[model samples]
Target: MAAAPRGASAADFETAATHAIILDHRSGRVLFRKNPDEPIPTASMSKIMTVYMLLEQLKAGTLTEDDTFVVSEKAWKKGGSKMFVEVGKQVRVGDLLRGIIVQSGNDASIVVAEGLAGSEEAFAERMNEKAQELGLDNTTLRNATGWPDPEHRMSVRDLARLASLTISNFPDYYGLYAEKKFTYHDIEQSNRNPVLYSFDGADGLKTGHTEEAGYGLVAAAERDGQRLIFVLAGMESARERATESVRFMQWAFRTFRNFKLFADGEEVETAEVWLGEKVRVPLVTAEPLALTLSPDMREQMRVEVVYDGPIPAPVKAGEPLAELVVTIPGVETVRQPLLAGSDVARLGPMGRIAAAVGHMIWSAE
Candidate 1:
């Protein structure tokens, strides 16, 4: 392992938000976390789940972008941010999505809920079911609009996981979050997520604010081929939320990186074989191996193969034979399975006798 750098270790990093988390999108590695699992009022951030439900329908072919839903008086009368949709008027699903994502419209969420599940209460039930299905154990949805309610809560980690699911499962629709503004009924509203405007490479996600939840954001960005998903909640103000989101995201990108150690099926080492037609069997990784670590840690990184013996008569190709162990300072050691690259047939009876005699003679030297 290399000497620890002097400036700032990942352990020393901190954030002001009451609940926060950062995750490596590709590997699902948690880069940073603070009170990540405690469910708290999520405000409009819960709308991410609302949008997710809509996206699922779209992906399943049950709904289309051209689909329209009537905006009920209930939706029109609901308070808070809105898409300024007219009551009793039919609105397109595409526009409603824009309304909810870019405008953070509580009304748009209600419209989606009613359009899909007939009522907000039913839609919330579906959301809870889906939450469990998706392994968001700490999330609970009370309403489609994420309207202030004591029961509407989600943890920062759950929010980040939801963000990851949305981006990976609905790439086509996820881009809508990057839109700077949305216009409906001649009313224009800029996206509430400030990171899109202030941070480079930031594309999509949701932001939230309420008296109880304070201010929060679910943000993601892609630089190079790697993407990061992060959540920040309970900030004092929107300005602080914006500042801290960008700052924490920048720190995360600057501190850690994904390093590809080996490609899929690439030979890692060779293991000796006893009484086999072939003297050695090639060892390879079944999948590409990558690790997230600080750039400076590369110099101290160590990789080695571990296997029990150089024995066995017949070996099947792709059979698990050894382990690839990786060690880096300040990071947990990673272990990957190494498999036999090709089949090694057992030696013939005569060949085994000759091989044993040769081995004995070679050992005498």
Candidate 2:
């Protein structure tokens, strides 16, 4: 594996972990990927999905923070990092979320699955459905608690997507991941993600470990306005994996800079139009587009505009006018649609005459 920059180094990582993934949460640009598509055991990282499904229930009003769930004898018997919930005790939905998130409590996770979906198997179905909705094509669900399930699988790239969607779509509820500790039945249990304390800008995320899965972490960190998410899986040791994650994130932030590709409603330059009152309609990116740039190469970068340009002027408000093509040296070209900012009416007689004259003058030039 390549070495990380000075502050964050994989050198400290003794593990020969094969896969890693990184993404910029703010720009939605992938910064780095190693063995990205290969399916691997998600280990305890599966809990992230478990939490996501639970949040879905809460949002749909099927569950509420104030609702209390009684821990069954079966739930308390669950073995893993735990919030120490005893059998027959009632725990709030909110408390269980914190326990599962911060403490990585298997008991809380199972209770949540059972409470929300009638059974853990039923909850796994929900997990798979949510993964599909998020475009996590490489992911499969087996357990609701991130417990060992050979059939349970996901890839580093897909895990990053899950983290991104979790953070992006559910900001109000995702805060449970940031809590350092959770208390239940008077027992205070701490979070397992080491990066939360060891790395700067490191915040809410989940960590996993098992004899078969080794050590894994799905973490998100923010420095300045840029937020980053990554998944580190199949490591030999816990400490090494944590160090490597921080190293990877630090490298991503220092190595790339954000560039604004387009702004909302800005005239994306003009495009040729025909038969409408107007000869050309302005093209714009449907939304604010952004990209990551290498510090040295940004100054030399350029954007190329293309497409049918003004098209026909009878275009509706959302009529596609042109394609704003972006060309960055040594990178893939990205094209965003340039739309008519507003409705351009069909040509009036004067409008047609004006267009004809304008076309003739342009042809002469």
Candidate 3:
């Protein structure tokens, strides 16, 4: 986008008790934030961390959908958004997922915690470690279940990051978030995540609530092939969260668009080369890359490419030789590899001498 889009404020959510934020989940661009770093209890939205952690076990083959879990009295007894699992029953990973995602079951969350980390407290400790690794600077882990604890807090930006990582890192498990309803032990419980049926292209993420936390939602949506994720961490009611989420998604799609700097191997891009006949081979990116920009960005966008000049006779095709850069202020420059399009056979002694002379002559120009 050449121009900036309309902006919202965390301050605008007057009823919100904590910071509010909206971000482009795809682009990792912050659309709006109010006290964005102020950490507040995320309610069940903290389960986003739980989901990600469990997926690790699944990927490592330590857990499987068919794996049976013996429901403990503790799991059966958890309060808030439950799949109503019965005690002394066997719950498989697939069904437990329904309880966790669809129902936001505190029990399921705890069970997964224990199953993976041997204790809910240990899993909560891991959650704290992960928070540090993800750079959730303002987030604090209080428990595996996002009960209304005073210390269990996260920022709106942090929540958005958690949601984004979940989708990006786990495509297969991401589908579970879209399931609208789940049955546990013969009881049907629907997902609390409202975005799925309320709006088009809305899927994924989690919702949270508490008397103190108010209503918070992390929702994602896609439109016109562009995906957007929204985080509203402290709304007074569910209505505002849903409304704000939809509005933010629309704003992101219409206000920002992508610009391409150059096609891959268009020439003159800088890159690193190893063990080539030439000291520093020219480079090109294997593929073209683009950037999402504001409308005003076009005025400042700069593209620079640097590569080894007309390679020696010994140059070989497909060698990394250079790099192409698309620079946008306030964003990392895009670098793509540049490669030799064709091979140059090794030069004889006379050929090398002649080539050196030719190089000198070309340099004179």
Best by lDDT: 1
* lDDT comparison, 2 vs 3, better candidate: 2
lDDT of each: 0.87, 0.76, 0.73
- What digit string (tens of lDDT, one per residue) describes model 1 on residues 42-62? 999999999999999999999
Model 3 agreement with the true structure over 126-164: per-residue lDDT tens digits: 999998998888888877778988888988789888888
Task: Write model 2 residue lDDT over 1-365, tens digit each, in one string.
Answer: 01111122234223356777677676555566667777788777888888888787788888899998888777889887777887888889998889888888888888888887878898898888988888888888887877778878888888888888889878898777777877777788888888888878777688888887789899998876667887788888977887777776676777766666567777868766687766666666688776666665566566777774447667777777677766655555666777777666788898789878988999999
Model 1: lowest-lDDT 10 consecutive positions: 1-10
Worst window of 10 by summed lDDT in candidate 3: 1-10
**Better by TM-score, candidate 3 or 2:** 2
lDDT of 2 at 288: 77
By lDDT, the candidates rank as: 1, 2, 3
